[model samples]
Target: MSQFLSAIIPNEKYYEKSAFEQENQKVFQESWYYIGLTSSLAEKNDFITTDIGGKSVVIQNIKGVIKAFHNVCTHRFNKIKTERAGNGSLTCPYHGWSYNQDGIPFGIPLKKEFQGLDKESLQTLCLPEFKVDFCGKFVFVNVSNSEVSLEEFLGESAIKLKEISIMIGRKIEYHEIPNKANWKIVVENTLEGYHITNVHPTTFFKQGFTLKSEVDFEVQGQHTNMTLHLAESHKDDKKRAKFHKLLANRPFQPEGFFHQLVFPNLSIGSLFGITVYIGSIKSVSPDESVFAYELYETNLGEGELLSDAISEVVKFSSIEFTRTTLAEDKEICENVQKGMEQSNATKGVLNSSEIRIWEFQKSYMNLINK
Candidate 1:
């Protein structure tokens, strides 16, 4: 059978405010969002804040435990920690109310001034907390308090996710790119290798990356994943050998390159199981989104860090290559968004090579339509 598919989602769905609202409530809000790495919060009171579907969340490491809560202050609803990432006690700068790891207000400055305030009332004024879970050191926050756990949400993909996380070390690059495109447009761009020949000719194509024909797709529950190995032509390339030799003594070596999308918005990709990229696609509006990513190298165990020369090469190669690739994607996705509202067509067509995109669209439609 010819493997072609029609885009299940309509063009209007890509640029409509109503559709964005529905997806925010039903899809992103109800799902677990990959926020940041646990390596970033290595010490007590270390916290990273993020906004998911208009709700702000803060993940903190308190006394060796990772806790997540709404970033809002209970007294005035102002965001307790406005900064993106920091290390500090969970104290509201607005009114000097400090919360414990459980988010209950333990210190209310000038408590006697407030009339009718009691210990029970103080206990009830706890900061609303969300469910926090992890696979390896990758932290995920669920806002809806859904019955489904992170492992349940990830399904079989959890194995790959955890494997990738274990292979990786601390973050080396953190970037937040404002995309002038619908969040889905940004996401769908990452789902397929069909655009590699055109959109990433230099950044990806010239780098020995395989195109759609060589890509393998697998559907894991609502998630879609693709794996790519070295093309025959580049198998013996000297640069590839040098790159591989840099981590020849690592505990875990990557078999191939893989990209995985965890349902609604989280994307994880890795270069030979090392140099992993984790991104969360956050919806800002109907036609706007933020693509924030963190890049990490393979873990080399304690005191076994690569030499400065090797580390510099790794950092430079990881940053320059990924930055260029993402820049190309941002431009293309933005251009697509501009035409989305002007297109006369109802839906675009899909090919066998683009099966992952179709799988993603189906998962999206199933959730948004529910």
Candidate 2:
């Protein structure tokens, strides 16, 4: 790291309530958010509701096209959909107001109560919509009307992610964890390997992963990618043979594990032949954030019994390992949040190993200050 880049970011960026509000408005609301895989809403009317910044959003598939809208009912202002995901027309649980998959108001109860109202007049009552786009099978939504396309925002990271998404086939598991920490804390924790030896010693370090003396860091716009090379000992013929056998039937094989940070709050850890874990941070407040994860595995399609058995064992083991590693990160992030709240210091120093953290802080400061 350059001497000029190794400085402490202000503590207020992590724990200050006012600063959190500003970030929500300026950073998250204006940026594109990765929702999930396009296959998540494969059938018509399949919908998923999520929150961006503090605003509620409902995304659904309608006649093969994906659409997003404010989750609130236009009539009563009640949330249109409360469940996390399901397959059905969006309906307001409050008063029976219903919307089509396109978010167009199609049914409003009590026809006699609103005598003059009809479908033609109701067309103008469509739910407020957001912009939606995709990169491979992954879907992203932007709340702002900014002209920047998702591809532009993603840049080089998009190319890498698209390759990984294709290899992973489709999403197999989804999980959400609510952490008692600022969203920044969770994101910063992921952008560097400085904590792996200490924080994930048994899981990552034991597996021969380390922060190399000469780290290869690439920054494209707000996105960053860091490549981790496993120790040569871990790449011996025996283990290499086993890995190749396990992934023999898979369509795309990854060259190596990659840790990528998609600016603002998406962290991706892609382990070749193991799993692809995408952790998306959703800030609930200054001291709370929800981390949503979608885990994907390589598509094996149909195979012989022996091959299927080996694949299942590998998949199960990979999922378990990932779950344990994520739990470790979650615990550390929560503790960091508590420390920031009680500390009197204004900032903390960064080391060379944390160059990505510095990059993230700089990116964040640029956006919030803008």
Candidate 3:
């Protein structure tokens, strides 16, 4: 674990189109992708459409079972649905071809034009489905047909993630910000807290957050969790006691903030018992990506205006802090992207605090090279 060693991946890998294409095929397409929360499709026939490595996919809840399929029409290869989420059977807009919840084509206009095409034969035209799974209320889809289950892929991180989701109770806010940087940069920035004192001095570090020592580092399989503790000197005994009393009845009692990074693209930051921030990074191209944030809060009881107001204020402030931090990180990433795209740019070294970044880069290289 030499601190002065160079980055695992070369600078060209960050902005090269060829490297991006390889990653899309090997990493993004092969690995499981986090979709929206399960609550997003609460009813039968409810479906959500999204893209994986530029390939469209649709996930639907049919008769209590969740299923995923390629969102392309079998007739003319047209995208059947483009909406984010909806309820009803999938019908191709190109023609009147209708598909059942299971992705089987059930109806087609001009029946006489296709004399040999009946429901039985039309089964061949069914949409191609991918592997779909859930962890607590969160949904995930893997485009690859590999036998490895999402649970296995997630390993120990699965249970921790589910626990956090359950503690948060319900999702209260969701937003996605398009980023003009590579996905790896965003993920790397998240894996370590070394930048907090410098990059987030005003927002996070100024609030008494201190990164856990290396001995406290916890890494399981492809996931890593770093606990951020509040400085003892910054603790207010009276205020702390009041907050604990206020949230005593809640399901999850917060101790300190915990930041977890699931290899490749997911990052979760939980602040005491106040709020949980789940972020997903999706690559759009060699130099473009999307950073999505899902904020959740614990159940504080029903119709309590004061409690609700407190929660609202916390959520609003959290969102603002996250936005400010992201803006700062994004600027750095964009600049890095620019430097990496240049011919003379060389690889940089990682400090000991950035060990997680090194681990992530190694995992990524292993996958893409495999």
Q: What TM-score do all the candidates reach, one by one?
A: 0.94, 0.91, 0.91
lDDT of 1 by residue, 271-341 (tens): 77557889988899999999998887776654266667777777888898889999999999999998888
lDDT value for candidate 2?
A: 0.79
Q: What is the lDDT of residue 32 in candidate 1?
A: 83
Each prediction's total of clashing residue pairs, residues at least 3 apart in sequence or on different chains, is 0, 0, 0
Residue 103 CA displacement from its true place in model 3, Å: 1.4
What is the per-residue lDDT of model 2 for residues 47-69, given as tens digits with 9 covering 90 to 100?
88888878899999877779999
Local error of candidate 2 at residue 174 (angstroms): 1.8
Which residue segments of model 2 deviate by more than 4 Å? 1-4, 118-120, 170-172, 211-214, 248-255, 300-307
Query: Candidate 3: which stretches are off by over 4 Å?
Result: 210-215, 237-241, 300-306, 343-345
Deviating ranges (above 4 Å) for candidate 1: 210-213, 251-256, 301-303
Candidates 1 and 3 compared: the better one by TM-score is 1
Candidate 2 least-lDDT 10 residues: 300-309
lDDT of 3: 0.79
